[model samples]
Target: MQAEQAGALTVSDKPTTPMQMIAHAVANGAPVETMEKLLALQERWEAGEARKAFVAAMSAFKAKPPEIFRNRAVSHDRGKSTVFTHATLDNVCDALNVALASHGLSFRWETEQLEQGIIRVTCILTHAAGHSERTALQSTPDTSGSKNHVQAVGSTVTYLQRYTLLAATGIAVQGQDDDGAQGQKDQPITPEQVASLQAGLDETGADIQGFCKYMRVGALAEITMSGFGRAVAAIDAKRKKAGSA
Candidate 1:
């Protein structure tokens, strides 16, 4: 009768989970080795399920991505006192936090000094299910505009943190490039322009991350219409130099 009951417990209309299997084994007085195997199997199953949940939440977040805009402006002292606008870290968090939380997701940043003057910032996006994804960006300190050593490091860390979050989420700021002086028409480059630049980069063996940093944008697509010509020229120069070599 006990054996029959055990068999019945193991049989179910729905698929039996690893945990259920472990319970059935325990009730049947299974060996210690069997219990250990079942526990390992259960752990694997849970991890796989958590990963699936993470992917689903990310998809939902992207479907209705948050719209972020440039909220802070910086003015340079040289070259006609150029000014540019960028979405601050606070702006990015305010725009994304609610949406991300609603989908059971959250993010945090980690910083490391890779070498002298080079800082690497990593953005970690975690789901409620215990799965996480990370994106990292590295850059030197921003010593421009009379910043001290501390301020320069802080500036670079903030910049890398903001960009790493954006990169990890696969989102970009909407409306206007970083250059506020371009007025209202400072739109992002067209898809064709993006493709052209990508091709040039590929041909020249250029590092896309370095290129984005040099262009003062988070991604290639975020390059401004006004800056498109300059980007292309830079790429052309690289291509020519590579050909000569």
Candidate 2:
């Protein structure tokens, strides 16, 4: 009988010794060189299988279609408001950890404060079989808000960290909060905002598609009126950094 017919071990079986080789050679009545070749083939086959399994797991995770609750909002003057449908850091961590752990996939962030008060955020996704991918973004702090200096820095870090992770994973948020009954809804991106965004994109040589991904939308025209200011500021920051470089 062949060694495989006599219950040869698989990679997932956690074989700890050359015992399988010995048993296969003995059971199959095989020569030593043949046994060595068989062992090598098994190793290669196992590696290929591992890669396939990793891909399957990733596909399954992505197929589920993640959902993030829009639990926060900000009101502007004249009964105008801009609602942000974003996932909190804790919510993202909680939502992803269990699903990723099951697939031997995990993620982490590397943050750095560069000169001129720029913050760089990198999100790295790693798999158990040594495959990995990453996405990176840089931004200045949220100085326009009433936040103090530290809060401004913290806000930027938190925003970039969350977005980097989402962009890295290709996850999309699905919920939007529109609770506060208010005046006429805010309009979409205005002509002035579009001009500002286009100029910034030209100055920085940033791609419109990449900027949309960073903004978590399908197109530049989809950006809300409230988000246009922040988007313009982010692009200007990129332009400034490019100029300095």
Candidate 3:
């Protein structure tokens, strides 16, 4: 991730312990070497390298998120755009809604409600501009019922704390509360509050990249097309697993 991309992410103040780094890397099934690599890259960013090696690393981590996202109704998007889609868009929208809510910028969405019995799910986010973003998602059940032992809600909420930091820093537009502008006369999330949110995320043990994972929902929307990757991963994983078996 570039500093521009890193600028979009929130970094922690405390140096992460090797044990904690290993646990996070393993929990997500990430390569243990990944931590050292990412940390070194961050060091370059700090040292004014202007150009450290920017091998696409986020794609590798999103390959799997330690099942932390699955049970919490989250999904990995290896390489994709962050926009509305007919499939694979709900998670990002839901995550955005959650982030905005933290700053009193809540809005109503009907994607999940409408997709309850239908196979097609379209996630929507309505802004004050009298417009919205929509992503159509196709929900598929895991036939093997391999979902009983994944991470719990605690992990999901913790992950959210990490994301709130990114929301405030990446772009002022993202941090702006549309609700306040759209006739809901609420207070906007201030710059100071944004800084505080960043601080809080660090206090909770979020590593730099972990914070990126938390906020990548928007970056995925802003930087890559996410739905395409989700569809591909689902199909490929099923086919590869079946072939190996």
Clashes of each: 0, 0, 16
Off by over 4 Å in 1: 1-10, 13-15, 179-245
User: Higher lDDT: candidate 1 or 3?
Assistant: 1
Worst 10 residues of 3 by lDDT: 50-59
Arranged by lDDT with the best first, the candidates are 1, 2, 3
Tens digit per residue, CA lDDT, model 2, 26-68: 7879887888887787777767766777687789788774677
Q: Give the alpha-carbon lDDT of every model.
A: 0.81, 0.70, 0.34
The segments of candidate 2 whose C-alpha lies over 4 angstroms from its true place after superposition are 1-54, 76-85, 176-245
lDDT of 2 at 26: 71
Ranking by TM-score: 1, 2, 3
Reference-based TM-score of each model: 0.68, 0.52, 0.21
Q: What is the C-alpha RMSD of each candidate to the true structure, in Å?
A: 9.6, 9.7, 24.2
Query: lDDT tens digits, residues 1-245, model 3?
Result: 58866665545523365555555666778875797776676555544322121111222222321111221222223253222211122443455455543432323323221122212233343333233333333322222223432332223222232323223222222233221122212223333323433443344443545444644533222212223224223333443456566
- lDDT score for candidate 2 against the true structure: 0.70
- Shift in Å, residue 12, candidate 1: 1.8
- Flag the better candidate by TM-score, 1 or 2: 1
